[model samples]
Target: MADWGAIGAVKSAVNIPVIANGDIIDAPSASRALELSGADGVMIGRGAQGQPWVLAQIAAELAGQVYRGPQGHALADVILKHYEDVIRFYGPDLGVRNARKHLTWYLERLEGGMELRNLIIRERDASVVLKRLTEGLKNCGPIIEVAA
Candidate 1:
């Protein structure tokens, strides 16, 4: 954050909210980021991936409130949505090609994800990729488990 001192200073001097980006990927970091930037708020990017609740958590914490997302399927659903969005945004060939990155990103959060990530990277067919992803989701076990 200190590395962005000049940008922060300019924004502060101008009385405009100078949102700092990069590096900060979690709530704790977001708080420290606010202190470091001396700005009005923090901007979350990759940190919010697979965790849409991150924004809410940061906002809640900043407001002096306790924040926690519902445990089961919360992370998985978001990752799935991200994958769908990628496919939707990019189309099959390009989407699947582009999906490699997001797929890797999604799988990285899963246990034993590296192996799956490697497989995804090697795959060339879009349908195969989606199939493997569905299978991976099933075999990888519940991202969120509800205790009976």
Candidate 2:
């Protein structure tokens, strides 16, 4: 749980905007944090993990807008694009190493993903990782069409 009381004290003592942070994972948590802290806003850190859409989801809740997370091919597209960018920036070897955590996070929620995630995380070659990932997505159903 977050120390929302401490945050309230800070808000009362300061004239500047106080943004409550830590442990805010969803709309309900974010709302509760603000109600308790009386802060101007909240910040999301680890909540993003594999699901980058969390920020948008929370924001929409605040604004009373309807939004849903990406799924199926959309999810595959986001994951694949992120992997490609990481590889481009870090090169094949280091990229594969760095991307394991993110991939692990992304795939953890997928049905029947444990063995596939373990395989991808252990592989050293970037090409093989990408191949396995693409194939793994296919195995899940509705394969992502990565643009060539």
Candidate 3:
């Protein structure tokens, strides 16, 4: 958790908006941060990694808006699309290497992810990695799609 007292102090001293960040992982935490720190808003870091839709979810909660995150087949589609984008942006060789970390993060919270994590990080071939991802997603169960 962030030092709310310090944030409050800073907010008082500054004319610009004060956005609190640190160890805020969900909408409730964000709301608490705003209340405690008297901040204009909150910023998320590690919490948003691999789970891109988290920010939107948090924002919606704060704004009292309705938002539905992708799940099941929709999640698989998003992950596949992200994989393809990474490959296209970096090209096969480097992209595969770079995407390993992202793939691991994406699978971390999934039910049967350890095996998939091993396969994804171990394989150097993009096609093989993608195939493994497809199979892994089948076994991983429901997933929340992270926006790009």
What local distance difference test score does each model get? Answer: 0.68, 0.84, 0.82
Instruction: State the weakest 10-residue window (summed lDDT) of model 1.
Output: 139-148
Off by over 4 Å in 2: 141-148
Which stretch of 10 consecutive residues in model 3 shows the poorest summed lDDT? 139-148
Per-residue lDDT over 1-148 for candidate 1, one digit per residue giving the tens place of the 0 to 100 score: 3364555676667865678777666667777777766777778787765556768988887788988863446555666677778888988778878878777665666676667778778787777877777666655643332221
lDDT of 3: 0.82
**How far off is model 1, as Cα RMSD?**
5.0
Evaluated with TM-score, which candidate comes out highest? 2
Estimate TM-scores for all models: 0.76, 0.88, 0.84
Name the candidate, 1 or 3, with the larger lDDT value.
3
| lDDT of each residue in 1-148, candidate 3, tens digit only | 4686689999999899899988887789899888989999889988877778889999898899967677778877778889989999999999998888778777875666667788678788899888888878888855534433
Q: Which residue runs of candidate 3 sit more than 4 Å off their true CA positions?
A: 65-68, 143-148
The model with the greater TM-score, 2 or 3, is 2
Q: RMSD (Cα, Å) of candidate 2? A: 5.5
Best-to-worst order by TM-score is 2, 3, 1
